[model samples]
Target: MQRSFILLCGLLLALPLRAADPDGKFAVDGVGARSCAEFTSVLDKPEGRTAFANWSQGFLTAYNVFTDDTFDITPWQPQELVLAKMAVFCRANPDVVYINGLSALIRSLIPDRVIRDSPLIAVRHSGKSVFLYRSMLARLRGDLNAAGYDAGAPDAPFADGLIRALRAYQEDQGLVVSGLPDGQTLNALYP
Candidate 1:
């Protein structure tokens, strides 16, 4: 069956192929993806049914935020979204992850919880420090503007802020604050 074929390929490949980001740019391996179409179209293959399933699993693994019980991508299921979702998250509200975490902290102190959960912060820290998120976002935004996105261009919606977004995502994911995804982030983002 296709599942077995995927398993066989996984065993033979030696290296696990990472999935592309939302804009179909950053390849699974973090290389500058040349053809967004090619990367996103992997699942379009005749044998893609299995690949799509695996891709969805890996994508959810990377973030650990997607779950059958939690997400309701009914209008847009995760399986249908694996290719485009990451880029959208990274491009738009690149710092929202951190900012939202900061917001949650301030609310918690007032004995008010603005959001129920934030993957951006460890819950222990969430109730106490807002500075971590703010300073991190500010520094990250600076890096993003200096070298990241193109002031929000539509053609290249991903912009240059991705590195910053990725780093912030990495830091929040509890990996080293190297500001570089490396192995951990890749695995986390595409586990």
Candidate 2:
């Protein structure tokens, strides 16, 4: 299969005018996703266009993953509209990493521990990690106390996250390149 970025790039060129970001707060970074109108504008045919409409339902189903601040859309419907479009995109391109990245963005916004504890985060259904309710909080910053990750312990102060997430957070924060989520870094990330 083709790389998701190449598809995103082609999608940008293939799409119409408007802010491409789902947030519309920024330009299309090519790293995440563009807005719904932009994506829909490019649908020249009836089949794919119709498909776009059918899949929007998942956006609402999965909306819980995002943080609350995502509500800041100047015209809120656009983000929702794009998220709805993204649901269609997911059906067509389930393997797309950027889609997963966007999903990550959605969850990245929520803050409450109880909400984060919900199964929508990452339900490990089959393996050892099963029954696991991972949180964006651990992956976010400052909340890396891992309270949601390993319960019953006093937030052991253990550093959290997979290697990749830690690396991304480190690079984004201009922190020392330890590639680990320390309390200082976590606080900075969530802060």
Candidate 3:
């Protein structure tokens, strides 16, 4: 499964780049064409989960290639987080195709997409490290401040103040108060 996903990503990366066509129609392929109920039903099986994840990755890769000024649609998100989001969407809209849910997810992620390459920073908390783009951190700081969390300077490195603010924000959002800018935290903050 991992090998297939890697191969898909490689192939996607090698494709000729193109700009997004807002009105252009595209076909839904693979597990993406399945109904949301079918997608949700497959979540319990490992093979099913992997198939959906790979399809989602492939879609996102194509999105990166086609979308203007976008490198990654969800740079800070993990595979599990993406799947979780899909599950939520599927649960809410069981009659829709999985591709529709993916499209909606991509639309929600537009504001948080990485516009260009940026330095990847390893942020450590509780002996765990999460790699995040520098621009993501800056944007996160701005979001925190806008929400009255006051995460110090927007461009500053992760510090005690930022940790405190993240904790406060996480607590307020009813998320895990780990004081780390984890996938879920970032999703909640950005969303």
Candidate 4:
């Protein structure tokens, strides 16, 4: 009985774990299928520019979904920068997986600069100036989330989640744990 149990356990451990959706949720479209050579072939032409712009838009959309709309890096606006980066990566890594090259290019766009001053606190439920309050709060939440702090899900209208995320971020960054969107927290979040 003991030998049979051990064998069964070993077999179960060796078996591959299967997920309900093995392919993942996101589906890559036509442009995503092109090889690095094919993708870089038209970089200097007008058609290439048009195609790259469309492809980059898809990346931006993916970024939004991946970060839950909290990542504010704008790779789509400055098209030239992304195009140049992708071209360079593809050229240097011609034989590399296309997705790996693209991943490097996308990962390079994450912001590195830090905010200088501590901005005013943006309370979610508080009756501060309506527009400025909400916009500031949004930035606070977004930046915190980008810095790897879990600010709850997007579209949540409450303040406690933001406060908890902010507190955790502050602790991680060695800042005062006020749990409010003060300047030091903002600087750390942006940094």
Candidate 5:
């Protein structure tokens, strides 16, 4: 299932840019047009979750293709993180369209979008691992420094100092003290 999902993502990346209609509107199909309330109701089922994931992957790929100065709109997030965010948005705004919720999520992520490709680094803690762009690590270091966490030199390797700092920051924010840049940690740091 994971392999197929990865293949689908690769195909999504190659999709051609779509042209807008004469009225400056784009057509939304599939699960995108469903209400947030409907989306929330389906979250517990694997098929429904998979459907939303596929639609979201395609939508984000399209955004990357069409948006200026964007190589990836969500360079730091995993599919699970994105879905979690969507679930939260849908639960809060049950009357809104799912696509609109995705749009709002994208808007919030704009500030962290990767404008260019960068080397990825593996960050692992507590048996969980995530790959993050080096540029994102630099940005994380900067944010931590700004928040008085002192994450060593910006763009430096992820060392003991960085881990300690991350732990401190997470503890201060009442988040899981994972000592790794998890989705919640990144969101809190960036926000």
Candidate 6:
């Protein structure tokens, strides 16, 4: 009887500890769900692309609602268009990091401001630890390209094209030409 009792107690204790964190909700960095590694693992498969599409739909909806300042402003872009752009972006940079690409999309669409209600995934830092979202990085690239900043083919990473483009955009906007996407720069670019 004592052995059975001890076994039962042990089992009870172990049960709570066995709980899973597959989506990484308890992650310290808030970037636990669907990691870059996971996204790339299945990137080439049909099911993987489908899963990403589904996730993107949910992500976009959440993002739009999060960034909505008023009921008057429409979402920055349509889901289909954004998805298509992602496909193109993915194809162009086959070796690109998906999380970064996703971040870029978010930045491009919601350049006006970030939502405070929820935390964003895939946060990185510049030299000074300036927090950057992958989507924001992508948005900066696209925006610089659109404004004729000449970032090489509009790829990810803060490369030569992005640097030159940012400088040009800043100069044209007369906003100190810092070549960095600080709050003021984001406001000008998105607005």
Against the reference, the lDDT scores of all candidates come to 0.37, 0.42, 0.89, 0.60, 0.89, 0.57
Error of 1 at 159 (Å): 45
lDDT of 2 by residue, 2-41 (tens): 6998998999876565533677554323423444444445
Q: lDDT score, residue 29, model 1?
A: 26
The reply for model 3, stretches above 4 Å from the true place, is 1-25
What is the Cα-based lDDT of residue 87 in candidate 6?
68
Off by over 4 Å in 5: 1-18, 125-128
Q: Any idea what lDDT model 6 has?
A: 0.57
Worst 10 residues of 3 by lDDT: 17-26
Clashes of 2: 14
Worst 10 residues of 5 by lDDT: 15-24
Candidate 1 residue lDDT tens string, 13-100: 7664544566755424221122333333443564643544454455444333433232221111234443344333334444433223
lDDT of 4 by residue, 1-191 (tens): 99999999999977775433656544456555566776788777888667866777676666654453344444123456556667787787666645556666656555531122223333543443122234446655676678787886654554678778977887888998777665556545542
- Give the per-residue lDDT of model 6 (tens digit) for 88-154: 6666665655555776766655434433322223322245324455555665677677766786654
In candidate 6 the C-alpha lDDT for residue 145 amounts to 73
Q: After superposing candidate 1, which stretches have Cα over 4 Å from the reference?
A: 1-35, 40-43, 65-76, 81-191
| 133-177 per-residue lDDT for model 5 (tens digits) | 999988888888888988999978987778899999999999999
Better structure of 1 and 5 per lDDT = 5
What is every candidate's alpha-carbon RMSD to the true fold?
Answer: 19.8, 17.2, 6.6, 14.2, 6.8, 16.2
Best TM-score among the predictions, by candidate number: 5
* TM-score list, all predictions: 0.21, 0.21, 0.82, 0.42, 0.83, 0.36
Candidate whose lDDT is highest: 5
